[model samples]
Target: MKSKFLAMLLAVSAISFSSCTKEDEEPPPPVEEPKVYQLPGLYIGTYTVTQLPNLAPLRYVLAIEPDGTITTEGLGSDGKTYYQQGTWTLTGTTVKATYKTINRTSNEVTQSATLTFNEKEGTLTEGTWKDLVNSDGYIDGKFGKFTRVKDNP
Candidate 1:
């Protein structure tokens, strides 16, 4: 009876030790970090002209690259198709886009606008695109809202 009790105690001690050893083992490998999206893709969204009287709503699809290249596609006056290629840059809260008119009889224009982004809300608020050249040219002064779309075509 003494030998049997000793064997049972040893078995119980072994089981408890093994359980503690397994618990002390390292956890599974840490999860891999997610990849960050590069800022060199097309962002398509609508832009509302908020200024009074000229409250014209426009739909625009713009492609921006990190190398300061920009391409915009949208409708223009006379109800015809319009496409323009330009250069763009982001400095702090400002975005400047300079585009040369593809069609003849149009002026080359440079527009500078302020931008405010809310990461929590995933929203972008854009100020009016002001003409850099003409002092009295059409200054939009309009505020537009845009939402980021994943896999924007």
Candidate 2:
């Protein structure tokens, strides 16, 4: 009888201990998935003109489209409209583009810019822009920090 009771108690203890398994303990913290960014989006930033040293910076919003088209339009505090239409290429961490800036009077000047895309920080940095054509126009400057505001479209 004692042997039977001892066997039954040991079986019960084994079943109870098995039920308290690592599975019953809190599940290992959910594995986190890596973040993916839709590259084509609105990059909002400012540009400081190299020629006009003391002038206010020009605010720029670059709309990068997936169709290889990019555009930007802005009205400076001096009441001049600045516009850019061009195509962009992304290789590794570098974003390069060449666009034509259309002033209010319809005078278009070609310009090119290069920026470093920082995926970790969600920003565009180490930017530089230059006028491809020396024609009278805007957009000869280094870009300020650019932040991705909208994703896609």
Candidate 3:
């Protein structure tokens, strides 16, 4: 009788220990997804021209829209505030702006530049601007670092 009682107690203890496991507990809560940011508004800031021989500084006010439209106004070395209307597209961290303008000589010109953005640091990676329509010359190896000043609604 004593041996039977001991065996029964051991079997019950084994069953109880085997049933209670880590898997029986509830799982952890689900993690939330990260938010995505949109870049479309007025970005007012200053840009420093980082090229050899001529290191100029310029202030710019750029308006961008989700529909790939852009308007930029800035003062050039010619002592005139130039206004340009163009279209822009953002691919990853790179932004490409294409503009069409008529010079004082009544010649229509088209230009395009690609600007890369550093989302982590909120800085612009300067890229080159080339004339697509007019093969006059190319502005090679230029850098323009810009920071946001105001965001339009």
Highest lDDT model number: 2
Identify the candidate with maximal TM-score: 2
Ranking by lDDT: 2, 3, 1
TM-score of 1: 0.64
lDDT (0-100) at residue 95 of candidate 1?
A: 60
* Global lDDT scores for all candidate models: 0.58, 0.82, 0.64
Count of clashes, each model:
0, 0, 0
- Give the TM-scores of the predictions, in the order they appear: 0.64, 0.87, 0.58
Residue 8 in model 2: shift from native, Å?
2.1
Q: Which stretches of candidate 3 lie over 4 Å from their true place?
A: 1-36, 45-52, 102-105, 120-122, 134-143
- Residue clash pairs of candidate 1: none
lDDT of 3 by residue, 15-59 (tens): 999889888989999897654335666666544433434746666
